[model samples]
Target chain A: MRTLVGNHGWATIAAPGNTGNVADFLVCRLIGSIFICFSAILSGCHAPLSANNSSRVEITYWRTLTGAAGEGQEELVRRFNNSQNEIHVHCEFQGSYSDLAAKLFTAAAAGAGPDVTQLGTFEILQFARAGLLVDLKPYFAGPEAINTKDWPGTISTAGEVEDGLYWLPFNVTVPVLYYNEDAFNAAGLLGPPTTWDDFYLYARKLTVRDDNGVVREAGVALWNITWPLISAIWSEGGKLTTRDYGHITLDDPVVLKVMTEFQTLVREGAALLPDEASGGHRAAFKNGRAAMILDSPAAFQEIFAQAIGFTPMVAAYPAGKNGKVYAPGGGGLVLWAKNPATNRAAAWRFLRFMLSAESLAYYSQQTGYAAFTESAQQVMTNDLKDSRFGVIHDGLRFVRGDFSINMSPSVRNAFDEAFQKIMVDLADVKTTLMEADAKAEHAIAERGI
Target chain B: MTRTSLKACGIRRRPRCIASQWRSNRSEWLTFGAFVAPNLVLFVTFTYWPIVYSLHLSFLEWDLIEPSAVWAGLGNYARILNNPQVWRVASNTLIYAASVVIVAQFLAFFLALLLNLKLRGQTIFRTLAFTPYIATTAAAALVWVLLLDSKLGPFSFIFARLGVEGPQWLARSGLALVAIILVGIWREIAFATVFFVAGLQGLPPECYEAAALDGATRRTMLWRLTVPLMSPVIFFLNVSGFIAAIKMFDIVAIMTKGGPVYPASSTYVYHLYKLAFRDFEAGAASAFAVLFLMVILVATIAQFRAGQKWVHYE
Candidate 1:
């Protein structure tokens, strides 16, 4: 089974063949090929024992990052491989996040998915429901585990399914406010908005109309704006999903109020809804066409490179009247196999290697991603001093990615749609959200994980 | 009897000729069966059986995870009817299909006619026009994404300079379908142009000469003579283009992922994909697929009926 798990599904040997008479020259070549090859072979009857079986056990790991992050994961695996001869781990780049999930679900259905694949914190519930994941509760409960106290509470929350630990939070993120310093200075504004009311006030203050009354320079425009609205709703004490993760909670007035206020902002010309029909949110920001946009800390690199004539400053989201805040976030988490007799041993071994302090530092340093372990994080704390890192954890404080992996894409789609409708004036706040809520509930009820 | 039986009465024979006719009939049956056996087997194995299986499976509810599908009767179809997204998907499919067919086919026809003319570097011109068609949709959409990309894309950059704020091409709902339509047209134009060119080449030369003798202008000749002559081929192209456009998946999949909204830029096939893979609604997807097949069937029938008056082989 371990050998099977480590095969990586390469099946090139199964070529269909027909045995026919060989040409005379080919037969001579074949005979010659055998003798020539044999000359270089060591004259040992038994296979040379390079390393004994007991020296190391191999585990196959599937991850979904490419380029630098991919290389980081690869380096981590290499370090793990080199650390000791007791365990050899291989890392395979499955695909991007959505692509990985699709491939995973498809393969699990086909009974050929990998043994210790990386899963999102929220996806654990869905996979667990489908019996696609091996339960990690027993692994953590067993004597061979480290203390869970070092892990952040919020980061670990999404990884649990019905009080059972499912996966580790890998790269969690929250939507920090990224504003143009030059734009703010030009508008004669003091600083980033620290409250929702202040956000509206600054957006109004930031608006500059030309002589002809057509505004040449506008205030803050939200890019990738849906998650921020969700954050606002959460700050107002609303949830996007229920505690059980069975149905969506979009119809709640707190959520609707957030959407309605956003609509009013569009009406007042504080924010420009970039024509989604054209492309998406990032385009609006990168062109220096907008003063401010809300995006993830992971986006710090891209925004810095893309934005021109302006330095983007990262800030915490506005604190609502309730002193509440929300985070727009998620992370890839590791999970162990349930089959303790076979994959569990391999999974635990692999997990330990992957989450090692030195390994995590190498991974974090390479990708600019946060580590799941406190020890791993401590090693890279000096490098985390950028202004962008300050508001991120607070932004991720209320980040929710739980939608029962089965209903997530669909439910999130509904929420995204509702947000679009709100911005585009196609559907108003109350009706659109209600419609979305109904659709999301129907999707959830109809398609259980 | 049916129309064939009535036509058979046109043959005249005596009673004694009946025995000889029976012997001929037996030979004809053997030869006909032998000739059709291979095709019949293929049709049954590939086309008919799968269709039957799809129909059977459509009435059952199951995700890909399940070992066997559980029967759901009309439940899947009922759910689709109730869901607002399904209606949106159907409408979107119609808009996408109709727009692609009309726009692509018109452009193809005109371009093909132009290419058919005896011109300098006609092969080069044809190749230049056709390169986009042979290119994979994924590659084409990617290039289009970069070109039309609102942020760093060149098309958007140019568009900005022109004072036209181009929306995010693949992200927003208002113009997503149009973006998809544009990509679909680009992907299809080459094939249409090639097919149209073939149709033009196959035209009888005498009609044009006759028109010339009658002092018909080139425009008049094209409208009165060439266009009518190419009706049969045009009809075939239209039907095929219509079908292909209706079933378009690759362009939509690569370009939009049927997003920003549920019904805004979605199509039936895209809906089917979501239902089956994303939502784990295989039974509903299959049922929707059946409805989609019905649509195509009806369209084909309508096309055949409409073709009789307009499609002139001569």
Candidate 2:
């Protein structure tokens, strides 16, 4: 007989020993199912703890590397895991660099941050100042420390902050000229320009126009943003700031000359500034809308990946009156300050393994960033001598880090505002720069070291 | 004699029946509690706890990197009040919210009226109008970015074809805000339209019939009979729309990134984001959040107070 159990929706069958066999069979099946489910759940609950007891420490490493660069990092981690049995490093892709910064902030705030994270050169300073980063001095002094002298000076010294070394250099890239070979050929330009004057002339020549005087295709995409303008300033023997990074020097005559030259391209309808909301300047070159663009070496893989009917070409940044002086741009691995002693030791081991010559060489081949160590250079030569990445390696000799002070971000924002005023709003260049300089100075003072 | 004996037996059973009923209710309540406990726990943990914690954090100065927090009485609040950039951001937020509410609501109401006309394929038009409302804001904003791109964008390209050089939509300073407002209106109008349509459908037909009998024109009938009845819906939409506009983030983040830096298109939330995430000024960010909550509360209260003047339930 079926009996209702209280006012709840549950019911039970209270069958006697003499009841039908069908009811007994049903009851037996229900009990068997419940037993199986309970056993499965109990086993699942204990599985992880058992696994954890036997294994070495597993540390989380967050890096903001995507596409080919992400794959390279994954490969590096795989190699590291295979090389030893003591520590297993689980690497996670953390979106764009900006996204990585935001997530890292939240994660660190919650005290559940990754053991190691890749940080941009500028971010290294920001984090180090906030005391978020662990000083790698102890690691550098320890037995696992790689020979610092063997690494490229441009990349190795970029992550240095005061007396503390907070980052180990990984992928290194510099802005170089990426040109559409098909567009260059169609414009009857045999090779890339070597100087600023030729650069503009080639830009004009490469420009295609419709009957209505509308530019059907731009000659080049020259934006007024930090990197392109900085490259131009460096080429013109001008610096964005003083050597000590204590003052703004954007109003320098050499810098003004480069600024005027770029603005003139926009004015003459030969070059167009890609809207930052839309895909950046790189997008224009990729879509065949422009013949040339100034882009970072890190973009080489993406450019090749997106190339449809034509192979793109890379050239060293054009020289100015002084010479070629391109700024290196890429991120490096930085350890979070909070970690247990054993995890710290394992993290240092993982970091050292990832920063080796073989790893850098492998990473360089997978992504197009230049190998930034002497030993990696030998490995890359043996591995990728005739590859498309040769241009990146050639561009490396000219590269160095930008002026990155503690307040670099604020200073950069100030300059960027002035840049928009001059380029997008068509304001007077010198006046805007002067005003922006005051703002930058004010910001630096307000945000004081 | 038999009927009186039966009545006596019924009286004897009544107390036992009542006891059984009480026991049944207790078990039902326990079952209900068991079912709701999981969701209630989650809601309190994730939602209620964060709000309370943030309120607490508002009074403390701590960067996430620092191991501990220091109590800062009114320091964060004072800084927010004194900073001129905060004022500019407030102005931007006000302008954005006002424009979106006014433009989007009016457009949605008009579209609702149009769709209300007894016409062919009304459902299709209604569906098309509501599509953007259901579409993810981030994805739509990304598409809008491409459409309004200054150079080589189809919108600019089409304008050029018509012999007009389109203004740099997002590249220029103030113009970027305008583009964002346009996109906000585009995304939100469908929501307003759906509500307006529902209100329109629920309206009493006798009022319109009486006005028509009195030889009232379409415009007059609409203003006199329809609008007064629709006031409650309009009021509901306005209050909620104002809140949504004030809280807008995805579009601004995706489209402008608070840029053209000279005339930065930073909203209040965007400013707070830069403070907390970019600068690691958690205390200041929390303070801003508290202030924003107060602002929203005041605005909502004021809206409700003002609604008494015009909102007609009938």
Candidate 3:
């Protein structure tokens, strides 16, 4: 008369009348295992215990910063906590950018998301559209609002969605060209390449090959992601998407020219894409396998650390046919709508504290990111004395952020795939762009954008 | 007057007996509920509810952030079908799954046969063979990528020594899929070998002795006697291996990322992931999941039916 199916399922069912058998033992073990699993899950789901002094407002802040940047964020929180008795902020590092986004979305669905999060600038629009973000307009109108005049227009405006600011630009990154000064000296070059034509000439002159025609040292390496590629496109006077964000303009001939120039480097063995196994393209440059690399200025400290034998030089992105536009890159802090009213206000207070002049200066100095506010710039210039930060801050005016769209993730993926096809598979450039353009259009339409 | 009194007493006593029985039944039911409640609650909360909710989601248009889902009926399904990428991913998945099953089973059986022999360090060999199965997939993929790297990898150096140029394993289109498949096989063969070893030990020695008396060669014995006797294990491996292959994600994600172009190495799960998380099309992803579930279900049932014909049991 046993009603339960044991560990072996049908075997336990068939031996129903046997009261003391192996099936009974197995059934007990199975139940024990299930309970163990349940305990583990429950333990994971337990909320972080609060400090019991309940008068102070408590709010959770999740961020994707890691390494030195992560430590800087923790320092900021420590400073803010020390400065105030009204709010208690709990800062947690939540892995990488994509990892944080997934957690945030899942938490938002359960209405247990953090009071604040640092997300990519483009994501502000997507989250705002989904109503997961607080508009912050009311805060702007309030007395304690963040000063818009102190912030860089590039940083401030990039966080806007439909005229409503959804995020406060915290740390900013602008793409820059990092070159080996020793390699340039050996190659008899005076300075870093300033234009596309100069880039090709330097790349050819700096490239060195072995007896087997294997490239011993490549002139440059381009990251496979969209930022470097977009920088190249904009430098060539091409736009990925039109002004209204309604359609893509990648199929234009200017983009074709940019693609061809990039491909020629790989084809001629002067430059290459990052090999997935050997870390990244920047790794090659740091290890002296490549003469130059294009990467974010935020990587300045890391590249310098790994540059061991050579002096790492930071310069503006190599200009192309039309002008010297760089890619605007960085993440920003956004308040979550899932937070309680008091916690949301606390989060707002924390954001302002993080963006203050001294705080921004400390953050930028520690993390190698650019200071976004005028006051922050003055502090960096006077206190930090890092001239490289000033160069990046000036480059911000000429850069444009990745086109803001609610469906930007899909668009970015489409472009990544197309870039891979051209660089790795050696597919026809024009055909791949056409295909990617169509694919992005379809994604946008399907997303109801 | 005495008979009437006795009948009334009997009727009252019967009613009391019935009430006592009801109370005993209630206590028994309570005990049963207490025993089953932990599992029942967990099953409904995690497993059963999510399945039912996901099914409901397949018919609606909802991004997880949206307050309410819009009724889309069969629109999500239509979009999945209309998009040409689904078919491409499906075809790649089929190739990957079939190849993994065939290659992994062959390698596992051969290794198990070798390990079954009377050799020194037998335990060490078995442990070494089973290690990769228990290893973290992300770490293993990273190691594999390093091993296959062209410029600085040992494999490339070995190839160069042999006067052969190594292909860019993660860069080239056709080779990238091959690289992923090789890693997939590496991860699976260990598990299959462990199962095969156990199955080989379970075979009765009498059969082998009888086959030897009949003057059968070792090869003949393995083919005629061992394989048929081990058919059930082989069949189990085939079925489970195919399911694992179809659901493969981490290795591809960590290694190739469905890359080098469209229709190259993207699997069904990877495509569905892009839809759900990256694109925020939960409805379409749900529809895709429903289709994926049906596929695995049908394939599993078919394998069982096919097993009945070919699988041998004593």
**Number of the predicted model whose TM-score against the real structure is largest:** 3
Deviating ranges (above 4 Å) for candidate 2:
A1-55, A186-188, A242-245, A308-311, A382-384, A401-407, B1-49, B52-61, B67-75, B78-84, B150-153
Report the candidate with higher DockQ, 1 versus 2.
Answer: 2
Which 10-residue window in model 3 chain A sums to the lowest lDDT?
A401-410
The TM-score values for the models, in the order shown, are 0.80, 0.85, 0.88
- Clash counts per candidate, in order, are 13, 0, 0
Q: Please, what is the whole-model Cα lDDT of each candidate in the order they appear?
A: 0.69, 0.79, 0.80
True lDDT of residue A95, candidate 3 = 82
Backbone clashes in model 2, listed as residue pairs = none
Q: For each candidate, give the TM-score of chain B.
A: 0.84, 0.87, 0.89
lDDT of 3 by residue, A1-449 (tens): 35554443655444635544444454566567777987888887664437556688888889987878899999999999999788888998888787788788788888878888898754666788878898888998898887878665455667667767787777788788899999999999999988888988899999988767767789998786767778777888887875345877667788777887777888888887765555778778888889999888678778877786999888877787778776677678899997677677788899889889989889888888888678988887764455566667777777664444323755666677777778777778899888888887886776634
Best to worst by DockQ, what's the order?
2, 3, 1
The count of backbone overlaps in candidate 1 is 13
Give the better candidate number (1 or 3) by DockQ. 3
lDDT of 3 by residue, B82-132 (tens): 878899899889988988889998999999999999899999999999999
